[model samples]
Target: MEPVFRPPSEANSYLLPVTTGCSHNDCTYCAMYLAKRFRVRPEKEVLEDLAMAKATLGDVRRVFLLDGDAFVLSARKLLRILAAVRETFPGLQRVGAYINAANVAAKTDDELRDIADAGLTIGYLGLESGDPETVTRIRKGASVDEMVEAVRRAQAAGIRMSVMSLLGMGGREHSLRHARATAAALNRMQPRFAAFLTVTPVEGTVLHEELDEGRFELITPEESLRELREIVLHLELAGSIFRANHASNYLPLKGRFPGDRERLLETIDAALDGRISLKPEYLRGL
Candidate 1:
């Protein structure tokens, strides 16, 4: 079996592998699913796993579908799995999965609603960078407009979104552009949760090759912090939870948007001024 990955916030959730790998695994910087071909697990197997989980860890409150974009599964199949989940763990409070714009576009409005009503409530979207040039270079597999529309449609169907952006995804050339455009996009989407992760070139990925060949220039840690500040300064979220505390971040930041925006900026400024320490290079990871 392929290894599983989940959002940091889902550390306590029971992970259920409904899919083997990412449906669209061509992102330049990602190497998470390179060893596994994308495939939806058999319904029988999925149900059996849920049953085993229930028997082993009774009354799970939260379940996160894995390995990557489990939302790529058809509504019919997902709904069946959700039904089985509810039956197996009557106390299940929420279900979440990695989602992409293309997966959202493939599902009808009604299908999204039905899925939400059945128990799948939150979605994790990797809005790596909103700069069109960066988006193209990364082969993110979805346009900015497509991403905005997809998030909006999912939100309309009652699915709360937790959107993530990469701090240095555009490398040095497009750093500021990436930050500002990403903030603009987040302002438009108004996701329930927003997170920032620094871009790390991974082995076996195009980004790593680009870095090795000098075709890509990763921002310095200070530059990445500036890029993060630019995004935070421009963000116009309404009561959204903002986080930059991922392991990959040089400086950890977390607070509510609009309310804590100013304080967050001050924290960044302090880090910039050397009043607060940044995480060492050796501690950061993807």
Candidate 2:
């Protein structure tokens, strides 16, 4: 089995690998499942794993499906797994999974609604960047329009969308464009949650090769903070929970949208003015 990963917020949830790798794993900056082939585990094996968890852990309130983009599974299969989860845990509160725009787009309204009704209430989506050029350059496999539509479709089906964007994804050339367009996209989607992670090139990825060849230049810490501030400044979310506290970030930030927008901007301004300390470079990670 391949290594599995989940959102930090799901640290206490029971992890269940419904898929082995991302269905669309061609993103230029990602190295998370480069060595693993994408495949949905058999229903029998999945059920058996749930039974084992039930016998040992007794009951779990939350279950997070892994490894990556588990929402790529057919709605029927996911509904079946969710049913088994409810039966095994009985007290399961919610189920979450990593998803991509294509994954959400693949399912119909009825299918998504059925899956959500069966306990799968949340989805983590990687928007990466909303800049058209950046989106194409990264090989994200979905366009900005497709991304917005996917999130809206899922939300309409009662799934809370937690969208993630990557800071410095456009390198030095298009930093500001990336930030402003991303903010515009987020404003349109108005996701329940919005997160920002800085781009850190991994040795095995195409992005690293680009950096090596001098084709890409990562922005300086101050530039990244400026990009972040630009996005926050332009965002028009209603009440989305905003976060930039991932380990990959230089500065940690968290606040609700609209309500805390001013505070967030002030905090970023302080960091830029050297009044606040940023996370050390040596300590950053993906």
Candidate 3:
């Protein structure tokens, strides 16, 4: 099985690999599944893993489907996996999976509702950048409008959505535009949860190659904080929980929308003014 990649919040959940790699692995900045081919794991294998989990862990309240984009599984197959996990662990509260805009659009509203009703309660989506040019340049495979609608459709189907954006995805040249546009898009969708991660160029990624060729420029630490500040400044979220405390972030930030907006901006200001220390580059990771 491929190494499990999961949300930071799913620390206590059981990890189940329904898929071996990302369905769409063409994004320029991502190297997560470079070594693996994409394929849906066999049903028997998935169920056997569930059985083993039950035998060892007794019962789990949450399960995180892996490897990269588990929501790529067909509705029937996903529902079957959810049902099996529920049967194996009667205490299972919710199941979560990594999803993309394409997968969201592929599933019907009824199919999504059925999956959610079956216990797969959350879908983690990497929206990356909301600027059309930036999104296209990164090969994220979804336009800004498509992403917004995908999020809306998924939430309408009863799945709580966790939306993520990258702080330096557009580089210094398009930083402000990317930030403002992403905030605007997120405001329109109003996902249940929001997260921001700083872009870290990994080896073997097109992004890294671009950097090597001097075709891409990464923002400085201060600039990254400024971009983050600009993004938060433009957000008009209703009640979504926000977080920028990921390991990749130079400045850890967490709060709910509309409520902690001012405070987060101030914290960023403090970091900008040298009142707070930023995370060292050596400590950042994907």
Candidate 2 lDDT (Cα, 0 to 1) = 0.93
TM agreement with the true structure for every prediction: 0.98, 0.99, 0.98
Q: Ten residues in a row with the worst lDDT in model 3?
A: 1-10
- Please report how far candidate 2 places residue 237 from its true position, in Å: 0.3
**Candidate 3 stretches greater than 4 Å from native:** none
Off by over 4 Å in 1: none
Error of 3 at 159 (Å): 0.8
Q: Go through the candidates in order and give the clash count of each.
A: 0, 0, 0
Q: Worst 10-residue stretch by lDDT in candidate 1? A: 1-10
Q: Write out the backbone clash pairs for model 1.
A: none
Specify the poorest-scoring 10-residue window by lDDT in model 2.
Answer: 1-10
